[model samples]
Structure formats: C-alpha cells, structure tokens
Target: MTKNELGIQAMQKGNFEEAAKYFSEAIEENPTDPLLYVNFGNLLAALNDHERAIRFFEKAIEIDSNTATAYYGAGTVSYNKNDFVKAKDFFEKAMKNGLESSDLFFMFGMTFIQLEQPRLALPYLQRAIELNEKDIDARFQYGLCLAQFGQMEEAKKELSIVVEQEPNHSDAYYNLGVAYAYEENIDKALSMFNKALDIQPDHLLAGNAKKLIEEAINR
Candidate 1:
C-alpha cells in the first residue's frame, strides 16, 4: 500500500518507470529516510545509471553514515563498473557498519580474486560456502582458490560436490580434471576431461587437455 512497497513490487516485475516514479514519490514524502535513498540507488544501479546511483548512495550516507545498506549498494555499483578497489573498500566499510551475509562475503572474495589476491580471497569464500552451501558459484570459486594454493585434494572435493549437484556443469568437470592431472592420476584426469567435453564439445581447454593426456599416455 505504501509508495515504497509499490515501488519494490514494480522493481520485482521489471517495470522500471513505475518503480522510479513510486521511489521518487516516496523520497519526496520522506526526504530524510536513508532507506528510501538506498532503495532508489539500487534502482538506478539496476538501470545501469551507475553515476546517479552512487550519488543517491552518497546522499544516503550523508543522511546516515552508519547505513550499511547504502555502502553495500555503492559497492555493488563499483563492482559492476569493474572498480574492484573501490568495491572492496566499500564492502569492507559495510562490514564495519555491521553488515554480514553470504552475498557480501562472496562479493568480498570475488573482489579479492579479481585483484589477484587469491590468498586473501580464501577465507571470505570459505565463509561464504559455509553460510550457503548450495551456492554453486561460490563453491566453484572456493575450489579454484584452493587449487591456486596447491590444496588439490580440497579443490577436488569442492569441485566434485559441484559436479554431483549439477551433473551438466562442464567447468566443474574441467576443473576436477585439472586437479586429477595435478595429482598425476592421468586416467582419471582423462575421463574427467572427456566428461567435460561431452557436456560442452566446444570447451577448448577441455578438448586440449584431453588431447595432451592422450599423447602423453601414448608416449
């Protein structure tokens, strides 16, 4: 019934114009409500108006510096823009402001990975997986980070779970194959690569891996 609720409904239905109208009306009615500005910032971010979205988020922060949601919204926009440094900063600030969730931890991990700090990414990704075990992407990233750290057995365990949960995941199969190859289990690696290729014939890395394994076995 409220304008903010109607705006949320419109946003959920992908009616951006109506959502914007309602959000604007809500802001007009309660100019000091930091949540209203945060919601509007989210809408603008979804619309790819990153500059305006950051402005709204900053306004929300101006009104209430302790609003974690505003920082999170700004961080999301920064992440979308590939400004990983700013994204990581804002995400950390959100955490300091008492925001804690699986999604936030996942983003923190991903931002670290993007920054080529896989070591730093590990703890956040591990926590993310602990919080939401069903998150395939988070599990995959965690597995990849483990692999980077030479924890091949742990990597295989995580990737195996992904394949078990989503049988058609070609990337999981490919990564699992890589882990097997690292462990020098050539036959198992070859089988895993073949499975990945079966699911995605155009997977160049899997195809190349299979070929290399076959050649090495023949030699």
Candidate 2:
C-alpha cells in the first residue's frame, strides 16, 4: 500500500505515532503532493498539535492553492483555537474550492454561531442536515438556530424529532419546553421541562423555567 494509505490506516487504528511516521515518510517521498501534507495536518490536529497542524495545512495550501482539504484542516485548527474569524475565512475558501461535505457545512455553520451570526448559520446548518440526516448534533444546532430566528414551529418540529431519535437529550427537551412556552401552552411546556429535569437533574435552565412557570401560576 502507498505510504499515505498506510498512514491513514494506522491513524484509523489509533496508532498515531505509527501514522505520523508513515505520513512523514510519505511527505518525504512526495514533497509536492498536497494530500500528504493535508493528511499530516489531520494527524497533527488529532494529536492536539494545533500550531503544527496549521503549518502543515498551510504547506498543503502553498503547494496547491486549490486544495480544499488544506483549507478545511486550517479552518478546523482555527476553530479549535477559537479563532472564529480565521476559521470562517478558511471554511469559505474551502467551499469556494469545491469542498462539499456535511462536516464542512456543519463547521461553517458553527463558526457563524460563534461569531454571533445565527442568521448566516441557519442555511449552512440546514444544508448539513440535508446532507447527513443521521447527524444528531447538526440537527440539534439547526433546530436551535431556527429557534433563534423565532421560527418556533419549525424549531419544535426539529426538536421533537431530536427527542424522539435520542430520548436522553435533555437540551432538546428544554428547547421543546421553550417552544411550547412561546406558544402559550403552559401545561405542555411544564411537562417538557419536567422531562428535561428527569433526564438531567442539574439542568439549571429547565429547573428555573419550571419554577418561574409555577410562580406565575400562583401569582
């Protein structure tokens, strides 16, 4: 097998050291191959060597400006470092360079959220869900984004599915409670909050919401 392929196999097997060795050899064997650098960047990123990972991704981009994966890798490193502005730029470049993946879309959406631009996050999060319906986190984020826009009905629809698909999701229940409360369905909202508290007793928001509802009823 090619050194790059072997490196990927080793990485998948959780042998990061072996993967690094293989990736290094592969890079040495084909210094001009942008894919090798991208792979090394991925390995470094997995190892939490963020600076080195970004360097490798930069090297890949230097080799081929159109290397989409290189931009994606850099974007991820920037995101991990909480450099949302840089992450947003790199992710946009990756998209422009034809990188089309649910993960890429999800990251871009999340970056927008971190930048406090939920309006921009919505479409990308929705696209991520469309690409991979089984991605629960993507759907959850999308639902939250919808809720942020006061699209309560749509948000409830998505959150309802989330709770159905993953019954132990306390946050989904809490959000559903919020949606119900928005609709003035106090009883249903309280029931949803109770479910959230049942799943996670320390869910402060759910607990506080329930208390407020009860207090309001008493008043």
Candidate 3:
C-alpha cells in the first residue's frame, strides 16, 4: 500500500505516531506533490500542532496556488486559532478557487457571525442549510442570526426544528424561550426556559431568564 494510504489507516486506528511517521515518509518520497503537504498539514492539525500545520498548508499553497484544499486547510486552522479575519480571507479564497461544500459554507457563515456581522452571515448560513438541512449546528446558528436580525418568528421555526430533532438540546430550548419572550408570550417563554433548565440545571442564562420572567409575572 502507498505510504499515504497507510498513514490514513494509522490515523483511523488512533496510532498518531505511526500516522505521522507514514505521512512524513510520504512527504519525503513525494516532495513536490501539493496533496502530500496538504495531507501532512491535516495530520499535524489533528495533533494540535497548529504552527507546523500552517507551514505545511503554506507549502502546499506555494507549490500549487490554484488548489482550494490548501486554502481551506489554512482557513480551518486559523478558525481554530481564533484568527477570524485570516480565516475569512482564506475561506473566501477557497471559494474563489472552487472549493464548495456544506462545511465550507458553514465555516464562512460562522466567521461572519464571529465578526458580529449577522446580516452578512445569513445568506451563507442559508446556503449551508440548503446543502445539508440535517445539520443541527448550522440550523441553530441560522436561527440565532435570524433572531439577531429581529426575525423572531423565523428564528422560532428553525430553533423549534432543532429541539424536535434533538430533544436534549438545552440551548435550543433556551433560544426558543427567547423567541417567545420577544413575541410577548410570557407564559410560553417561561415554560421553554423551565424545560431548558430541566435539561441543564446549571444553564445560567436560562436560570436567569426564568427568574426574570417569574418576577415580571408576580409584579
């Protein structure tokens, strides 16, 4: 088997040292192959060696500037490092280079959210949902973006779907409560908050929301 294949097998088996050795050998044997550098970069990123991973990704980009995979890899590493600006730049480059996928769209959407531009986040998130409707995290973020944009009813629909699909999602319940509260449905909001607290007793936001609603009702 090729060294790259063996490396992948090792990674799947959780033998990270063996995986790294195989990937390193593969890189040595195929020094000019951008894919090799990209694969090695992915392995290093999995090992949490972000600096080395970025170097490998940069090397891949230097060797083959047109390949979207290298840019996407760098973008993911930057996102993990909390470098949102760099992540956004790389992700846009990846898209410009024809790397289109639900995950890529989701990351791009999330980057906009991190930059506190929910309006800009909306369409990318919608595209991600179109690509993979079953992605609960994307839907959750879409709901949040909608709420931030003052589209509370739309947010409620999305968050409701999330809670229905994943009943134990405390955050979904909490967000649903927020949506109801915005509509002035105080009883429904309090009930949703109570449900969130039932699932996660230490949910600070839900606890506080429940207390505030109760006080308002008492007054």
TM-score of each: 0.97, 0.97, 0.96
Q: 55-122, model 1: which lDDT tens digit per residue?
A: 99999999999999899999989999999999999999999999988899999999999999999999
| Per-candidate count of clashing residue pairs (backbone under 3 Å) | 0, 0, 0
Taken over the whole model, the C-alpha lDDT of each candidate is: 0.95, 0.96, 0.93
Q: Give the TM-score (vs. native) of candidate 1.
A: 0.97
Clashing pairs in 3: none
> Candidates ranked by lDDT, best first?
2, 1, 3
Worst 10 residues of 3 by lDDT: 35-44
Report the C-alpha lDDT of model 2 over 1-219, residue by residue, as the tens digit.
999999999999999999999999998888999999999999999999999999999999999999999999999999999999999999999999999999999999999999999999999999998999887898999999999889999999999989988999999999999999999999999999999999999999999999999999999
- Cα lDDT, model 2, residue 179: 92
Residue 198 in model 2: shift from native, Å?
A: 1.3
Candidate 3 ranges with C-alpha deviation above 4 Å: none
lDDT of 3: 0.93
